[model samples]
Target: MGTYKQQSHVVWQCNYHIVLCPKYRFRVLTGLVKDLVEHDIKMLCQWKDCEVEELSVQPDHIHLLVSIPPKVSISELMGLLKGKLAIKLFKSYPQLKQKPYWGNHFWSRGYFVNTIGLNEDMIRRYVLHQEEEDKKEETNGKHFTLFD
Candidate 1:
């Protein structure tokens, strides 16, 4: 019953906590590069219709809490973000293509992702209370009515 986003055919509230690191975990995400990365990420998420609940960019890694629509898979989003961002950064700052990043990859090969949702205890309590209400309705010789 929390806030949800509606599409033409579906309503959803899928959220994810994502952690990504720079290739080789370098501290290259500093100064202008950091600013650009942050800006570009926001832009990309907006393009994907994803809402960024929280974002923290560190010198070596980034933590992002985002709500994404069900139509877009997480792997697809990650791939687009990482691949495009790297290309943009390399083009913007050719120096980034040097040394450790000579392989032309910016982000690490793997990232961490976890789903975010309501507290489990809260959901359990709701389920238990609903069962009790249903029992009461049955005892009253009345069936649950959607319109009512």
Candidate 2:
């Protein structure tokens, strides 16, 4: 089983592989820009209580593998990350405000996200095994009835 995190009443392991791109797919993420983006992403994830398993900042796109709590929605997390990062980047490096990024936007409008979890066959087998055990318990001689 995968390592699970726990809250007050629930335990979960929700991980996502996310891909983000710059506006118009610009190849501007280099040198200091790349470093700043990486730092900002880590900070944003930490603020939301999420863990960044892996991060790669390419020139035009980014690949992020993160483990988020059940309390946080993927959309919400993405919005926060994108919005805050754009603002921070623009403020940190005003030169980015010129050219192709005139709309005050840094990231593309949409992102790609996929879930990461155990294989379906493993889950199916565990479910079937549990049902079998339940059947055996019902067939044993220690049955009790409310009427009795």
Candidate 3:
């Protein structure tokens, strides 16, 4: 559980469950790639004064429970996370650029987010099982897009 943060005139708990995937749902998040993503996310959260309560990096997607400050908007935070990760990933693994993604974009256009309140436990469980749940889904040899 995140401790209450005291900002100018308010005491608040701003926690969220955020999930996102790579462009075209590519299963590239493995081995060193997975380690890089995890490290980058932790560093980003530390830089932004946020707390990462839980994190799961699946082959095709990422699930995170984070506590962001009240001063930041979810969209702004997501933009920073996605944008920075893309840049880092591209630089660290140049071969990734050869993949079929438009304008060097490494992630999809949108993401999934939910607020965490009293149901933090439930959210934690969900994040933990993300990989298992995804593996159970029958894609029928077809790729799925979140935006679709």
Give per-candidate clash totals: 0, 0, 0
lDDT of 3 by residue, 20-139 (tens): 999889999999999999999999988898889999999999999999988888998899999999999999998898836445989988999999776768889999998777776745
Ranking by TM-score: 1, 2, 3
Q: Quote the positional error of residue 14 for candidate 3 in Å.
A: 1.0
The models' CA-based lDDT, in order, is 0.91, 0.92, 0.89
Pairing residues by index, what is the TM-score of model 3? 0.75
Pairs clashing within candidate 1: none
Off by over 4 Å in 3: 100-103, 119-148
Residue pairs in steric clash, candidate 2? none
> How far is 147's C-alpha from truth in model 3 (Å)?
60
Full-model lDDT, candidate 2: 0.92
Candidate 3 achieves a global lDDT of 0.89
